[model samples]
Target: MGLILGKISVETPKYQLILKTADYEIRTYPPSVLAEVTYDPALLGDRDGGFMILAKYIGAVGEPQNSRPEKIPMTAPVITHSAEKIDMTAPVVTSGGGGSTPITMQFVLPAKYARAEDAPQPTDERVRIREVGERKYGVVRFSGVATETTAADRAEKLRKSLERDGYKLVGEHVLARYNPPWTLPPLRTNEVMLPIE
Candidate 1:
């Protein structure tokens, strides 16, 4: 019988822990690029469709479009709801009044290929590669599924904690997952990140 090798996880984006609170942390991350797709979940609610489309462009299910496309190592916590920073006491819930909002799913390109031009193009038109500039974040760590309710709740808690600590909010919250869906529930890693300035 042939040898069996389990899945290998690639390195996540580079970041430095800058501060810690009773329930959250402050981290700063360097600018990096990502391949993403923005779709109105109201119309395209099926999660698999968006994933498959982006996957194909990233060579997850098809041939790479670039000279070096070989299914760039998959990053953690496939983000279904993503962003950074804030204003006002309101959470500014972006769910578009309960499910009418657009969802932008993304895959963080590896450090070696973080530039948009350096990255592969998606065969599917729905997918596009873009760069994310460096920014500081207020992060809250949690376990279990990274669903909307969980993400929203953690985001509010993080935001409130940051504000309580005298940090000025600078951006929206981004949902980050570090493990595939199949990973054991208790072992999964999830974070809600908000920008600060």
Candidate 2:
């Protein structure tokens, strides 16, 4: 596993400590898993939504045993292209949707990779996967199943806190899940993240 500097803090929305930074690893994918998946980045609105994701820090990268799902461990950092500050409150503009949004968003960075089924053949280097360099984020931690209602509730609370602190939201809230699907629902680790301006 690699070690990267992380800025740790405490957030009250979910009553848990938070760690934020850049240069950490993340595995991104197309929105195909959901019925509402869309490629038009514009479709990603200000509100939050449910997503099926498998995220973990680099330390946990490995093939699962007996074909069980792998347990990836995600750290407290984000990866971005540069160290420049971001405007969090600005909306993510996207091209209007056509019949179907292209599924070109599925690309994994150096520190992350998609599951075999979701990834292109190893030799297909045309996939646009690369490291994001440095990214700033605000993280709110919570335990239990990350249902839409629960995520929205926590996001609302965090949004209030961000506004109070004079931080504008940079993008839609991305929900990160850190547990296997078969795990007990009550013990899951979910995080709501918004880029800050």
Candidate 3:
């Protein structure tokens, strides 16, 4: 069954499993390039807003890249996190208030593009390409249609589990979904990830 899924699964960021507990797992991921877009959650309400922009960047919408249209293969999981105020160098800034936080959605580039420069530039300026350094995360996996409420609940669960194990969490919880919207709810794969010290 796993092999069958692997055959049809989209490319996901590579990670080494460092540890696993009953509730969650600790994994170390190497540095990788990502194509991302940011949007105001207060206005957009959900990831669909950012996902569409990144879909275009990755040619999922048949959009052209720099010069010629480069269609990059789709990858998983689609990562979403609330943009931190400190990282507000981009035009998208979030002022703390009622649901005004800006959310960033990222698509991990294929391994062939090891560096940010190696990846094709997005025609949309809103779509930024960045390289993140290697990092460790405590992740809790679940399957379902991940709504905001569900994701937040899972994140809290993951946080408690990590804290219980004496892990110092470093950043905001990240939600990653690995299947297209059309996938069956029970068959979909989703994860709530918290960076750890």
Candidate 1 structure quality by residue, lDDT tens digits, 32-107: 8888887765566553336666666667666754445667766655665532222434343356224455567888
| 1 or 2, greater by TM-score | 1
Candidate 2 local lDDT, 108-196, one digit each (tens): 22233323343222222222223232344566777676655566566666666767667766665555555444546655566666656
Give each model's whole-structure lDDT. 0.70, 0.37, 0.78
Clashes of 2: 15
Instruction: Give the poorly placed runs of model 2, Cα more than 4 Å off.
Output: 1-130
Angstrom error of the Cα, residue 69, model 3: value is 2.7
Q: Please give the range of 10 consecutive residues that has the lowest summed lDDT in model 1.
A: 1-10
Better of 2 and 3 by lDDT: 3
For all predictions, the C-alpha RMSD in Å is: 4.0, 12.3, 4.9
Cα misplacement distance, residue 26 of candidate 1 (Å): 0.7
Q: In angstroms, how far off is 159's CA in candidate 3?
A: 0.9
Best candidate per TM-score, number?
A: 3
